[model samples]
Target: MPDVRYVTQGTRAAIRRTTREDGAEFVRLARESAAFHRPWLTLPTTERAYLHYIGQLEREDREGFLVCVRETGDIAGFININNIVRGAFQCGSIGYGAFPPAAGQGYMSEGLGLVLRHAFGPLGLHRVEVNIQPGNKVSIGLVKRHGFRLEGFSPDFLYIEGAWRDHERWAMTSDMLDQRTGAG
Candidate 1:
């Protein structure tokens, strides 16, 4: 195993930038988490796809991180900041999922908190958005817990699995994070 450089740490989990070396582990984890993610999102489950994903994350407009268990150094989940628009916009969209062993364990919550701090503090992002299907109560709850507000709904917002899926847009700003954490 290569050295894992954590970008940020929380009590139970840490976030690290995703790397090409993470391909195999991510594929296995995707398989393990398939049932949990089937209705919500899709992950790279093959080596080629994983490599492609790594390439995508390397782009300037995107960033990816793996949420790892702090004690055991195991991958608990992944979060990606995508479609970043710099300059006057300073915004990004995010997608994420938790692996089975970490599911419902609050690791993702800690990881998300760390990621938001990283985004607003170091990355200089002013806003982050998430799109969730209305039926995905767990995901909805996750964003709400982090203080994301429902902005609107989009018909056929994304193409997923075998069809176009409708999504509810949720967003949070740097000011919101600062207010939530009392850091502003």
Candidate 2:
């Protein structure tokens, strides 16, 4: 089973597995951060869609959570690794977004590093990919900082803002994770 520990980074933030019980809080955060997150996250403008999305996230094995916040309980960010597959393809893709207040504070970076270890080590994933819109410099930097290599450009990889968008493909293998953070 996946361990859902309450993770901490000094007084910076904590990351824990999200549950259906967290629906209201997650919705509240998503609503409040809509303007900031909408460009990257598919924030539902309606309560019904919000509930449906969270429900799926709660039940799917293709998903895992890294719900993060300051020690004071302020919502900082969320990390999601979804669409997991095994067999010859022991890999997954990651997506993340932070509240405006948390941007550039290294919270997302730290949370991502921790989650990568969990994905590649305990989770036995061989590779992880991050797909960022070509113009999302913030996420591009985050992936690069963690030693992800630009593999290629994927056309129409995501639908964001208003239409389908191309993304710069970045990937890291378990070996790269070990070298970057010495987590192995």
| Candidate models: Cα lDDT each | 0.93, 0.74
lDDT of 1 by residue, 8-41 (tens): 7888899999999999999999988888898788
Give the CA lDDT, 0 to 100, for residue 161 in model 2.
76
Scored by lDDT, the top model is: 1
Score residue 91 of candidate 1 by CA lDDT: 99
Q: Cα lDDT for residue 137, model 2?
A: 86
Best by TM-score: 1
lDDT of 2 by residue, 1-184 (tens): 2233564343466667666666666677777788876566676456677677667666544565554654555556777777788889998888888866777787788778778877886778999888988878888998989999999998988888788988898999999988876655
Q: Distance (Å) between predicted and true CA of 153, model 1?
A: 0.3
Alpha-carbon runs more than 4 Å astray in model 1:
1-4
- Root-mean-square deviation of Cα positions for candidate 2 versus the true structure, in angstroms: 3.4
